[model samples]
Target: MTDVPGFPPHTQLLAALARLGQATRMDAVRNAGPHNLSPLQADIVGLFRRGAAVLRQSDIVTALASTAPTISDAVRVLRRKGLVDATADLADARARLLVLTPAGEAEAERLTAFSDGLVEAVDTLPEQDLAAILRAGTRLMRELESRNLIPMSRMCPTCRFFVPDAHPGEVRSYHCDFVDAPFGAAELRVTCPDHEVRD
Candidate 1:
């Protein structure tokens, strides 16, 4: 059954995603306002707080799925604000690795706490439902990355937790050792926060 000008499943999904994105941006703006930081600057600081130690400018671009020029602009603004510092890479003199200043580190801690609190406040889903949603979202992201619509990820296929089926007769063709559960190609996660890199 269909109605004229009605949103299909895809349209509804896109609209939901867009609204979430806008809400997230507003949250960032509100949180960063007191520190005189933009959303991008806050994001960069958050990245470092999340264990990204000394990354190149290109790395930030890739992680944020943003353009080099946009990242450069943000980095410049951050440097000017004394929240970030850069030094030439020893191995590649032409390249620079970014690090957070002492002030930046303190701000990062505050921002991380604020972000965690905000997320906790809005998160109403049960654990099982949240896991299901995360799996589905990661699957969609993987599909997009496979189609070259998004950047490649540190995902299941490249993770130590992944175990490919060794026997064609197996009922489940793939497994996630971490979850101890069977997984299908379409259900494989592309951006699991718990992902561990394969040796």
Candidate 2:
């Protein structure tokens, strides 16, 4: 697409905003090491960080606009990794309540700091441009969420498109040697080329 100057109208502006937001998120994952979280896990952690008290699997699925299975799988991984703790919901034995562990809390803090730095950097942009970007980004994100096209489970670390430690808070966007194509929620499988199935 040709780059038209001055916020290429609404649709183009939203698409560009989505791309930028994705890029920023990928960058944050590259910088925060030790544990590599999938986008869904990161979102879950972020929600918890933002005071999502008493979350259920369904809640996460709704928030991330992902399929139930995808959210369940991500939650399982997070639980296995000791990043999240789950308990049977008092009212519904079949439903589990999820919460961040102490370790998860620490990691969330780091992630939040990284995100803050990212936003602060963006804040340096001219006021009008920054406002436009924010508006576009928010609109695009909401639209994607509604469409269930936002791959909550996809993460830079596990995707074939990811380049390990490419740079702090930054990873190549789904262009790594592992997966030839970018990953999405539908591609979540145990035999993915980019990542090994955790036992």
Best by TM-score: 1
lDDT of 2 by residue, 5-102 (tens): 76547777668767977877787667644677876678778777654556999888775677899888888988888889998898998999988899
- Which residue pairs collide in model 2, if any? 27-169, 27-170, 30-169, 31-169, 160-179, 161-174, 161-175, 161-176
| Residue-by-residue lDDT tens digits, candidate 1, 108-184 | 88886556656785577765576567567767876887687876566777689988783356545788888888866
Worst 10 residues of 1 by lDDT: 164-173
Off by over 4 Å in 1: 1-5, 114-117, 153-158, 162-199
TM-score of each: 0.74, 0.59
Q: For residue 180, give model 1's deviation from the true position in Å.
A: 11
Model 2 TM-score (2 dp): 0.59
Model 1 scores what on Cα lDDT? 0.79
